[model samples]
Target: METTILTKKDVEKILTMEDTIKAVEHAFEMHGKGLTQMPPKVYLNFDKGDLRAMPAYLEGKAGVKWVNSHPENPKIGLPTVMALLIYNDPETGFPLAVMDAMHITNMRTGAAGGIAAKYLARKNSKVFGFVGCGTQAYTQFMALSMIFKIEEVKAYDINEGNAKKFIEFCESKGVDAKIRGIEEVCDCDVLTTTTPSKKPVVKEEWVSNGMHINAIGADAPGKQELDEKILLRSKIIVDDLEQALHSGEINVAISKGILEESSIHATLGEIIVGKKPGRLSDDEITIFDSTGLAIQDISTASIVYKRAAESDMGIKIKFFDF
Candidate 1:
């Protein structure tokens, strides 16, 4: 049997944000209907960072992603997060392809945030806020722009250079953007937080009514970006209940007894599949706690694999004689 080797370039050529959002939405629908299998992420802790093993089966597609998160990597000329995925045939457990998952991760994570906003944010939301102006923030902007008619973007970062660079990127995209204080950023119609802060960086008082927040940074235990009080007042939805409770934005709050599992409104999937409601009123505050999902990677990978196979884009090598 031959296994296709797909490089980052190969995958990038085939994947698009539009297609990614569709694929991820389907994955969530399947998940809400109890049609997919995704095991809780297994983590290998390290002094500098951590690695995660994510495995999932959606419909007839299956895959495992080996990913790492090292916040200090950039100082050493590496990305804060990098990943690779092995796609397999569930029927025979055959390794069908191996591909880079960095873009897949970023796109799908952004797609999730967009999908969350679709159901949770007010339909007239036009002002977007970003608390972390890094690579992830770019994708988040891409996804949100596709969904809303964005009028302005408010960006904030501890590093002024990063925020300025992000503003330039936004301006090139023809969107009005400016660097703003964290409090000012939080005043937008929709707020996206991507900081890797261990403690709260966005306070409760800064967040206003009818705002939808995509809490993207806290994917590990003890890592939190928003104040616990914000969670207490918002209608909280998570990507995965178990994973969110363990390592998402609400983890610290839950551990500290400031929040309860029973307080969770619903999973994003539940809202997508109509099992629950999203943003009941214009005055309601909502938050989506995203920890990143394995099904998202697999689903996006499936699209990349299929498109690459049709175009004969990746290298194929026979690993075993059938």
Candidate 2:
């Protein structure tokens, strides 16, 4: 069978940030509607880097996709992570397209953060603090800026030069706020961490009351950002409990005996579906444990596959010899 191949630039043209937000909201809606099937991700681990293979399909959707996450490639001038999306022909279950997935992965991740904040953050949140100044940080900023009336933003990284570069980059992109140091960002209403650091980036004292944290980097076991004490002070919410138990900030807390899996207020999905409440009071500290769900992969893939076909963006392919 002939398979279609699409490049990263092509995907970027179609999957804009606004589209990503709506797609992520819809994905959560699908989850609330009970229409998704995802197998556990298979991980290959090492000291500084690893790869994850996540396969998933959404019920009533047209395709399935396998995505991966790999960190530690920037030293070699490459994206820290990448993906491969294989759309299948429904009639015979044959492969149709093999397309690059970097754009969509970043978009989906940003979308998840925005959605989580929409549900979890206090209604008056206007300041955003990002813990790592990188591409992922850029996307998170884009999504938040688009959805929230952001009055100020602060970002920090181990490399102060990198943080300055990000500030200039955001300034060029029309971010009208000052880019400050970690301690300066500690006062923000929302805190987002995207570094690959295995140690805590923010301490409990740094976080202010009613702040919402998006724990976006701790997707692997043994990877953590904020101290477990931050979790102890916050009402933890996860995308998925089982996944977070093994891979997100909860892993660190659980291992240290600071919190129990049962202590999680609710999954973000449950909050979306109204089974549980979000942000009950102005003084509540909320933390979103983002392990990066498989359902997110399938959600975007279905969108891209259909958009490509309708807009004639991908190549047509034949089935295998029969």
Top candidate when judged by TM-score against the true structure: 1
Residues 228-310 of candidate 2 have per-residue lDDT tens digits of: 88888888989878889998978877888888878899888888989888998899899999888767766776677666767
The estimated TM-scores of all candidates read 0.97, 0.91
Candidate 2 residues lying further than 4 Å off, grouped into runs, are: 1-3, 45-49, 62-77, 89-92, 319-322
Error of 2 at 8 (Å): 0.8
Worst 10 residues of 2 by lDDT: 61-70
Give the Å error, residue 251, model 1.
Answer: 0.1
- Shift in Å, residue 17, candidate 1: 0.1
Model 2 scores what on Cα lDDT? 0.79
